[model samples]
Target: MARHLRAFLGADDATLARRLTAAGTVQAVLDAIRTRLSEPARDALVAELTAATGGLLEEDLDSILLSGLLGYHGLVDAARQTAAEQDMTNLVTLDHHLVRVTSEPVVEVLVDRQQAYELRLALTVTFTVQGLAATVRAGRLVHVRIGRCSADVSLSWAGQALVRHSDLVDAPLVIKLGSGVPVHEITDPADDPALARGTARVPGPRVAQPGS
Candidate 1:
């Protein structure tokens, strides 16, 4: 009975599409945005303390910025894991058939210190797996590359605007997906879109950093 249902569902493109759609596969990716991306963004903001901004206001600003990036990256990591899990489930349920999976994740990071400092990051990450199901089932290296990611970053202190980047999309994040290939990560400079284009925005007047 179960086999018959699976066969009936997978027998045609329209049936398969409907079955996949009803399974709410994309929703799994969305959930990962909240579960996985927060830590890196928050951690990045804390790392900004390397600059030692001094006064309370400066400290608040530093915290917001570093933490924001940390949380963003963390979320990206989680999303990658979730995507991989979804792919694995698809492979098992659908056999070795190839399928295209796509998800657009929109995340907003807001770190506020009352009236002292505030950091807001509106980010959109386009995650896609174009027929990697076959490679995955065959135990081969699969590249799960993010399509296009855009970020609108804004920072404000004492009711004043400091820095802002609207629709910054030069660097796109990519995750190498497969067994023994390391989970989704931005380790390589060539693979890290955020590092390749530039570091995420930190609160302050945009000044030239040494390597940025």
Candidate 2:
């Protein structure tokens, strides 16, 4: 499952393995996914949304909100699919200490493949669920109320990934939702209209980011 997700996000397994204890693991993961995008894919995505909405949101704020909605859905879907593919019979307990990931992903298979990574099954893959909205400036924002989220997750696992999270090539124009952001913001790192069209930047990791 980890391998497939890395493939989906275009993350290099070797790099991830090496960074298992590094501070920049999350940033590195996001960059890997972000840098993979091509300009053309970004353009088409926005065009499709524009057509779907009958050009209702021609304004930048509206456009970004639309993008956030699309991006949020894509994130949730991919997370769910990835969660489903894993075999987690051995995931005995889901205590935080057993599965800590300050940045890098730790795929500690230990000597017990049968019981190792046992928490995968019991742990639900969650994202923002409701009370969600978006804001636009230089990029985008999927806003969550202070101390709250659409996913409504408890304080324990917010912002940090249960495992690994990364960006991809030919990906959407997303900005990092950096620490203390209080929302799932997918910003356009660069203000390129072409980014609006990258429909490939969705569930299952942006159409596999080219060499998926």
Candidate 3:
């Protein structure tokens, strides 16, 4: 009877025949069937089979085997959805109208010993207005701004503060300038010890000898 149902569900004909021919394969076939069914269907089938057989079984049984298969399917679907969302979120359209200038050899400066020097950098940015208006370039500087700094600096694009720099002198003297852009300038003082640790340090205040 189960063999007929297995055939109706498209189970391989040879495999079904082999299972039906062996008494030891019956339990294995039943386990395989339960794993392929969804939760509701599995429950319904289990109820029908148990009632028909009058609750005769030789070992403990659990729904976990079926539930695990469904769980595996659910996980696969969730992973696909997350990957799709990530792809959509990361999609960026390039703007082909802006000219960008990047300066290399990011400058490092030290202000003084014990106190780190803080600098406010200002960039005189020039854009080829003609290129942007015509969309002739492959890159666009959609916006320009300064990141955090230890000291405050007044910024102007033709006199406007696109971005403000703050917190330059804080601990961890290193500062990251901007996101997805290059830094134009970094200012540091000449007397910084971290910058000149290899140089000799001047002697501290000397006390006159009592004998002298």
Candidate 4:
């Protein structure tokens, strides 16, 4: 009987409501069933009904009364709370990180040769913290703080690569170059005796110089 009751109550909302109405008025049907059962049997059946309904049954009702009242209420409030917490746990925020470089005269030749010339160059400098990560929209900045700058000089010029982040400012760079040689190098005059040491001035942005 409990199984049949559960099945009837589990029907779609419209079917359950129609069957409940056709059986007789809900209160009249429950009163008839309650009068037929003994007190202990009725109490035991109500306990079973309470358990079957997951504690949703009223304490005063017999099983038949509860069975008559059964109606689906959508999701349980506890289940909804758990689902909300799970969604919060699944949410995440992404972090942002990027690299950049900035400088003046976006493109410039720090050194140029007339006809054909070849010579070693050296760079000694300190870079501003801002300069290291500043955006580099165009061209490249080479540091020649250490080692020999050697290249062949000719109409068809050859260039040499400079060492970057080398602490040894006095180190010489050797390079081989040919005619019409063009080289771009960075140096801190405050660190180079030949450039006449003084407070170094930071250069601002400028249009690319002609011939650069």
Q: Model 1 misses residue 188 by how many Å?
A: 21
lDDT of 2 by residue, 8-60 (tens): 22224333333332434333323434534345633332233223221111223
Best by TM-score: 1
lDDT of 1 by residue, 84-139 (tens): 57544212111112111111111122223212222221222221212221123222
Q: TM-scores across all candidates? A: 0.23, 0.18, 0.15, 0.14
lDDT of 4 by residue, 69-106 (tens): 11111112222343445332111111211111111111
- Model 3 stretches astray by more than 4 angstroms: 1-96, 100-113, 129-212
Per-residue lDDT, model 2, residue 159, is: 42
RMSD of 1: 21.4
Q: Which RMSD values do the candidates have, in order?
A: 21.4, 21.9, 36.4, 45.9
Give the local distance difference test score of model 2.
0.27
Clashes of each: 21, 29, 8, 27
List, residue by residue over 55-110, the lDDT tens digit for candidate 3: 11111111111111122222234334444453321212222222222111111112
Q: Rank the candidates by lDDT, best first.
A: 1, 2, 3, 4
Instruction: Give the backbone clash total of model 4.
Output: 27
lDDT: which candidate is best? Answer: 1
> Which window of ten consecutive residues has the lowest lDDT sum in model 2?
93-102
lDDT-best of 2 and 4: 2
Per-model CA lDDT versus the true structure? 0.28, 0.27, 0.24, 0.22
Q: What's the lDDT of the predicted structure labeled candidate 3? A: 0.24
